[model samples]
Target: MSRHFETAPGLCEARDTATNAYVFNQTMLRIKDPERTLDFYTRVLGMTLVKKLPFPKMEFTLYFLAAIPDSQLEQWSKDDGERLAQTFGRPAMLELTYNWGDKDKAEVNYHNGNSEPKGFGHIGFAVPDLAAACARFDSLGVTYVKRPEDGKMNNIAFIQDPDGYWIEIFSPENLEQGLSEHLGSDQDQR
Candidate 1:
């Protein structure tokens, strides 16, 4: 199907010709241990569980989570969910798909797209305070791929989840200021 977007001034909206609308609802990640993954996302990252859909026939469960509270999504239908997904500056919803047998087998592993071909790069999160977030992650024993102090991109940092997927943390103000100061007038030239 063909996809189109309507752009007016500063706003942009994605639309589908046939369907009612097209939204980037969620990014699905196949997780081995749901308990550990849920803890990492909820406790460490402070995401709320918005919806949980279980498929007994398919032998899998889908957990939808976002930074917003569950109360906000209580009345949201499928269309509302799609509209919510289109919102920018709001935390993107995460869909964790857990296969029923993975936990039982203990040997099933999901490729985090970091090795070999490296298809998926990383997911990013914008925080109000980057330093505090990094510090908290440190206290939680989260694995760091790159710290803000380690590289030229001092405003951004990357952390790895238990599944090895990289999560980038940054502040919008920090990124703007850092890039401007780092680049100076040479930004336009580059």
Candidate 2:
């Protein structure tokens, strides 16, 4: 019931264009509480707070976070200008935007994109150990959308952030093995 589409020839040939230097820097999410959201990302998820830019005039603040390794931590902490340069160069960084007065509001102002309207799907993070990671999330009182054993695809799990954003978790090995098994089953059925 699924159809596969090949890349158009013209688009495939456009790889030689000058856009090669472009890198996917980050994705932004609007959050209500900086304290709770920042704690969830930094303390629970173990991402480093790379930079914090406050726009008082705009009444919002930007927080950049990345899963930086220990070795690179010292370097990123050294200088402001260099830290920002390095942060911008990295891919898959998360930007959390907090409007100054949102914390005082009774209700969350933004949609997590997973409910009724359903536009943005979810963000993913590949873990080294799926079981252990899920356990850690459990101990930290994180909310779960799906547990690995709950669905047909048992290799993946989904956890929710403080702002109700879904984060898909999986191990690379398990994901590949799951795909292989599914494909083999499809072939066997044919």
> lDDT scores for all predictions?
0.79, 0.87
Give per-residue CA lDDT, model 2, range 1-190, as digits (tens): 2122543334454355587799999999999999999999988888999999999989899999999888878767478888889889989999999989989999756787888898987889999999999999999889999999997888999998988898999999888877666665334665
Worst 10 residues of 1 by lDDT: 1-10
Q: Estimate each model's TM-score.
A: 0.74, 0.87
Error of 2 at 9 (Å): 9.6
Over 1-190, each residue of candidate 1 has an lDDT whose tens digit, in order, gives 3233432354435544665444466788988889999999999988877678789999999888787656775544466466444332244678899999787786787787888977887888889999999999989999999999988888999998878888999999878877876664434556
